[model samples]
Target: MIQTDGAFGRPTRHAPPLLNARHAEDYWQQATRCIDLVRRKMASVDRPFTGAHPEELKRLFEGIDLDAPLGELRPALEELERVYLDDAVYFHHPRYVAHLNCPIVLPGILAEAILAPINSSLDTFDQSAGGTFIEQSLIDWTANRIGLGQDADGVFTSGGTQSNLMALMIARDHYGAALADHGDNKHEGLPADYRRLRILGSEVSHFSLQKSAAILGLGYQAVMPVACDDHFRMDPAALKARLEECLAMSLIPIAVVATAGTTDFGSIDPLEEIAALCRAHGIWLHVDAAYGGGLLCSRRYRHRLAGIEHADSVTVDYHKTFFQPVSCSAFLVRRRSDLRHVTHHADYLNPLCQAEAGTPDQVNKSLQTTKRFDALKLWLTLRIMGADALGEMFERVIDLAGEAHDELARHPAFEVLLDPPMSTLVFRYRPADLCETELDELNAYVRAALSRNGEAVIAATRVDDKRYLKFTLLNPDTRLEDLTAIVERIVHHGRAWCEAQAPTRAAAS
Candidate 1:
């Protein structure tokens, strides 16, 4: 059924779709109104954002009474449109190349419609039933895609942050178990020399690893930063040196976290070499493939994650690259037994008796007790649109990044970073006359000016304490011309800012 509210707000049904059959029609009618609100909003959206400031939106909500209800769905939606939807950032727009967020597929949205109404919680078999199996099936499929062997197992997670945290927790427990002085930190508490435990990651790796270190009771100090190469990949030589240094200092190197894709540069670590280093030291290997994990869907780019199969644990965020909605991600492990670290037998929930009966209790190996059936979105998406089709789409974005990087390098006024291993480009405007300090200010001003005018949305980051702009090209619909137009706007704003500062420069001279 095509969902539409069109130019009219008339009810399309007379009943609700859940619980009572009597109100089924009403539910579809109300659902259509909400769907059409989004449909109209996206269809009409010409810019990535509305340039609405915080104070402007705050004024819109200040006069509203939260206690009072509109008593009708239409009015409530109308109020939402005015306060939220109107000013909300449209990630689906082609110019929205700021973050890793992707334009979701229709199949995933349809899955959301079915899953939301039923609201199946995947904590236990009784609650989720078929949902548990569907999630497990997808986990198996993802494991196979990663070339993880038969013993591989995993559970769905909220996103990459939680997944990375889970990986580190398992690493901590697994490593702690082998130590003579440290034993079972999960239940027995941290060992006396827990301060000696260390986790190594690239300098360019996700911040989640440090956050995970803090959460694991190892303190942020436990994280050792390994240096990266010029292109921003974890240098294997640097990692080997760090490992030897840790051993020389009598510190316990618990794990090596290799980033498959660095956040800013889209650089993949030399995973094959890194895996070899982890194997040599018998250290737990955890690959944070959150951004590049989508390559698993691409037949052409699958080899980019060559050594991911060697990881003890891996974090993949479907929301980032798989084109799934938020809260859809998974944490995979090479050995099913490694999950014993995260397992807990709650008598009221997933009891030991259930395990004895050979029941699949997902909560036994999950960080979350109450979890949504997010796997359904992936399952339905794969079923309707084959993995090959999705892989082709991912390939397009990867190809687009290479083209943009080369084109950007030819631009005299801008400094484009190295070609991305995936679909991201880091560049900055550098006018000939400005000093290094002034270049930073000019690029930052351009980013803000574009957003201020609602012309285009671009992201900014700092490389070596110098400001730079970045393009995260996740949307396949975003073409070269669209990016070229954004570049024109950037140059426009940069020149304008320079001209406005001419008076100040003259006064300083």
Candidate 2:
């Protein structure tokens, strides 16, 4: 009832052939065509987004038939280019100050090209070979940069979210192991008093910590939020007070998740102070440096993360700050043996005997088994552009942020948040004629309108229940003038929307 293609179209006993050398030429041609289109799009100084509305996209996608392949490479590529590539948001554009996305370096792109064809699964030495070593080397390099001792070790993860999850998992297991007669939480679920186990994090910390607690059976209530200071950094005094309160209530504080770079405010918590507090309380310190990790190589800004070295574990997202592609992040621990908390031996994948016999398997440490070789992207980036070059780029963005902050502060139409600790600037357009409620609505409307028009892509967030726009300046080449234009456009839209609402508000009043 089935048919298999044979050589010269003759029937044969063999099954359908897998893609190998026989398809290499065709594959190369198709891949290069896609790459060429991407290169052109990246180079173009056009709108950051296509501003395609949801209804329009729904209508467009309805025409696509998924049951049958296009068969011809050229037609498929043309269709993709028309439907997707044309509407794709271009982070490399100078006006795109939207999120944590970065303009990837050339070496990272080239590394992707190489890795796609090889398709190496970086779980075991037998499968990855040199890939295992490369990933290990990167981990070692990152740990050393953090001043994590020689016993330090880590594994590449999907991104910051997964890295944070893995860090909390390790902390939970380590804490559980210390409890009376509770060996491993992985083998045995949390003890009967799991409700008392809690994770302490700043109010501004990423939401992943709470998610991790929920996933680890600790419940979202297990995460206690510590207050932050005037500058949005976690207040060490508040953290100490919370820890004492937890102790007084007979609650077990398993870990202190200090944020090196928070998402909205770009606030770097007082790492040195937090590290000392965690040390005194004997709490595991996991620093989520997903955004600020680039400061590791930044000669000028590296001091901002001075006490990161004291962390028990650190989450670094190279994709966010190192100009690498997505999914290039690692969760590092101070002691190599601590990673054993996540290890499991499988006869088919990694056997205990093979590990004992000196075989290096990355899966032993990672939450993921068949992981992508994302380390190669950062490796190639560092090799092609020296660490200092990357650092310089980071410095440029930080400097740009400072300039933009001053410019926004001077503008009467905008109310800038605390001076940026990193490259993100959070501000809201406050028109003189509008009240607090009206200003919030106006700012929110401005963000949506700009996105719908696709003139300049920016980010928006709420601070203290009031809407504020955020400019995440990750592009080193993004200048003050570009940001000024974006701000002007935001103001323009805010004013227009407010004026339009005036008649309706008067009628309602």
Candidate 3:
């Protein structure tokens, strides 16, 4: 029980300050202990998430209270240490091969810890004078990478989803000029004379684009998915056909979204060919390079993203491929004027003088006003590690994925899909004497077993109406041996499941 001064058996003083000196000291000591524990954990951890122990977690949070005193929290804190700090899967661990989240370099995290507490808003120059310069510098660097000229401008977004949404907003406002001033016109219903607007992208284009279309009053049907070739790339010929059909229907092609690297497979569409189509059709070209933007670091791989220069806008997620922490993404445009489509003003929030002073006011370009200074994390990442090192890390993950694919293909128990275009590998466990249906069932079993055992966390997706396990290689520390071990576990579990079901399967057969 906490000791408190009382008058007439009632607490005389107000409740203890939330963070008094004693509590602060206690927290500091606990934090120090946590740091030491983390260092020790990091040394031994390989795959943190999948390798996590769940029973440990249940016990940790069993009866923790929200309003508990600091002294009372000691037990819960100890419990948290027992489960999360000790048993949780560490992405920093070499064996973690689950989600798209990368093991962020320490420098980036350190910068965030400092900068976030200060809470600098990048919305305007008055709010973030030096921060504006930092953000612009990073945008310029990214623009140059996309082959957008020196005149190009951009702003850091929350992530790829925000970037994609901004791209659609610009495209829609440009094509449907009247709609910009009259969003209410949609409720009034699209004008009888309004030209039919459409967005074209590969079938595998990020789902965010469809949502963007819906938000813009274009309806989900406004997005037309073009055909993809065997490589899962947007087939230029098919896209041309779709555009021609739209033209025949008197529908205006507002924007053509070409994926630099798709989410499932790292497939790069034929960008140069698609760029030509956009030029000829006079439609906006927005490259969703959210997944493959890191390829800019690889001289050899950079060529795959050709025609990015011809694009009007591009969305790149630095967090995805650049090893930055989450929410660091940028949306860039070839011409700065296009940003005017989204520009808004209010006298109270952004006075005319501040706007007219020629300040680097990011609010004029951003969708949000009170934006966090997300640029510092990227800035610190580039400064401490340099672009070359970061690029090498990007290359390393892709190389590891390629190597794992080949090794998995050679193993008789596993069937690898066609080679990865970039880094993601799609494959499944195979058992002897199994038909196509049985094989699919066994693969499903393997995936479930991996999840239940908490030995490794892997993702699964369907291609061509068939399911396969997927590993999106984002962690540089994940090695070939680690993948091999995962495969072995998958096979072990799959074989056991198959054997257990053997009698029933035979009867059905």
What are the lDDT scores of the predictions, listed in order?
A: 0.90, 0.88, 0.80
> In candidate 3, what are the lDDT values of residues 187-251, reduced to their tens digit?
45454434488899999889998889888778888899999998889999999999999979988
Clashing pairs in 3: 46-95, 47-96, 48-89, 48-90, 49-89
Tell me how candidate 1 scores on lDDT.
Answer: 0.90
Residue 359's lDDT within candidate 1 is 97
Among the numbered candidates, top lDDT falls to: 1
User: Residue 100 of model 2: what lDDT?
Assistant: 95
Q: Residue-wise lDDT of candidate 2 within 67-166, one digit each (tens)?
A: 7666555677778877888888889888889899999888998999888779999999988899999999999999988899999999999999999999
RMSD from true fold, candidate 2: 2.7
Worst 10 residues of 3 by lDDT: 4-13
What tens-digit string does per-residue lDDT give for candidate 1 at 227-253? 999989998999999999998999999
Which stretches of model 1 miss by more than 4 angstroms? 1-19, 180-183
Candidate 2 segments whose C-alpha is farther than 4 A from its true place: 1-18, 507-509
Q: In model 2, which residue pairs have backbone atoms overlapping below 3 Å?
A: none
Pairing residues by index, what is the TM-score of model 3? 0.88
The alpha-carbon deviation from the true structure for residue 278 of candidate 3, after best TM-score superposition, in angstroms, is 0.2
